[model samples]
Target: MWRRRAAVGVPLQEGKRVLSLLDDDGRGSHLFLLNVAQAGEAGLVGTVLAVEAAAHGHGDAPRFECKVSFDRRGTGWRQSSTFGVRSTNLSGGLPADGFAFVAPNPPPAAASVTITLFDISSGEPGSALRPVLPRSRRSRTRLSATTTAAAAVLLR
Candidate 1:
C-alpha cells in the first residue's frame, strides 16, 4: 500500500510515451515507460507481488524477484521481475538486483505506458543462511535453505 499520484507526460514516438513519478511512487525513484496502442493519461502505483521460480539463475541459485505492475484502464496489469540470490559464498552475500515489468497498453501486449518502481533487496548469509535475533530478545532463530532443518535458541 502506498500513495497514489497522477502522471503528467508527453508523447514520444508513435506508441511511445514518457511520464514522471515521485519518490517511492512505484517503490523506488524510477518510473517505467510502456508503449501503448493508444495514448492517454497515465499514472503510477506501487505493489509487492511474491514471485517464486525454480533455480533459473546463474549457478542454479535461487531467484529473489521484485515486481512493479500497472493498473491499466484501472485494471490489473503488470511487468514482472526476476532475481538471483547466491549465498554459497559468504563474501558474495545474498546479492539481488531489481526487476519487474508486466504492463502493455492496448492489446497484443506490445505497448507500454508508464509506472513507478520500488526498491529490491536481499539479506546476508550465515549458518542455515543466517541467524536472526528475535525482536522480543527472548530467542534466536534460523532457517535452513534446504528447508530440511529449522532451529531456535531460547535466550534468557
Candidate 2:
C-alpha cells in the first residue's frame, strides 16, 4: 500500500507544462518529467528520479517502462524502453523536448501507479497523465502470477 500524491503542475515553456508525482511522505518512485514543444510537438526531457524499492534480488524491486509519442499534425512517432532489473538507483536523462509517457513495469495487480510530468525550470509537478497498459501485457502478467502460485503450492 504505497500512498502517493496527485500530480503537481510545473511550467516548462509557453503553452507547455509538466506533471510530477509526489508521495504522501514527499517521496516518490519512478518520477518523470515531460517537455512540450511550442509547435505542439512534445518529448520527455527529464531524468529518472530515485525511488527506493523493497530490496534487491528479493523480487521486491519495482520495474519501469517508458514510452514517448509525438504527433505532428497527423504523422506520429512512438518509442518505448523498458528498465532492466539490474537498473536501480540510477539516473538518466530524457530527450530535451517531446510528448512522452512512463509507467511501472509488471503493472500493479490491484494498486494504481501515478505517472507525472514535471517542469525542470519551476521545479514543480503538473497535471496527471494516464498511460494505459497494453492489454496483452496485463494478461501476460496474470498468467505469470498464476503459474508462480501453482509452482509454490507444488513445492509446499
Candidate 3:
C-alpha cells in the first residue's frame, strides 16, 4: 500500500515546517521531494529527516493524512505543493537519483520531480542562480539551471 498526500495551492510563510509522518507503530521510511514555482523573492530550506522509530518495517502503510495548523502572519505565504511521496509505488525505498524528463535525461522512474526554482525577475533567466557573477560575464543570456546544482544539475 503506497501513501501520498497532496495539498495543492497551499500558501506558506517564510519559515520551516517539520512534518512527523509515521506508521501506527511509529516508524518512518519515506523520502522527501520538493518543487517550487513562485514569483518574487522567495527561497526554501527543506530538511528530510528520520528519527529512530519503534520499528522500521511499516514502510507500506495505507493512506495517512498529517494535519497541522498554524496562525498566519501578515503575508509572504507563496503557493506551495500538496507534496506527494511514493511510499507504495517505489517498492523498497526512495531512489537516490535525479529525474530525466526527455532525451537529455531518461524518463522518470516514478512520477516525482525536483526542480531548482530561481527568481528570473532580474530579466536574465539565470540571474537568480548566479547572483554574484563577475562584470565580465553579465552580457551572456543563457538559462542553464545556473550551476551549483552540482551533481544533481542537468543543463537543459
Candidate that scores best on TM-score? 2
What are the per-residue Cα lDDT tens digits for candidate 1 across 73-123? 434554434333221222333224323233332333333443322223333
Model 2: number of backbone collisions = 15
- All candidates in order of TM-score, best leading: 2, 1, 3
Tens-digit lDDT string for candidate 2 (1-156): 222222222333333322233332334423332333343233223233223333233243324333222222233333343232122322333323222343323223332222322222223222122222246743433212211011000000
146: Cα error in model 1, Å = 40
Q: Which pairs clash in the backbone of model 3? A: 2-88, 7-82
lDDT, residue 86, candidate 1:
28
lDDT of 2 at 48: 35
Q: Each candidate's lDDT (Cα)? A: 0.29, 0.27, 0.26
The number of the candidate with the highest lDDT is 1
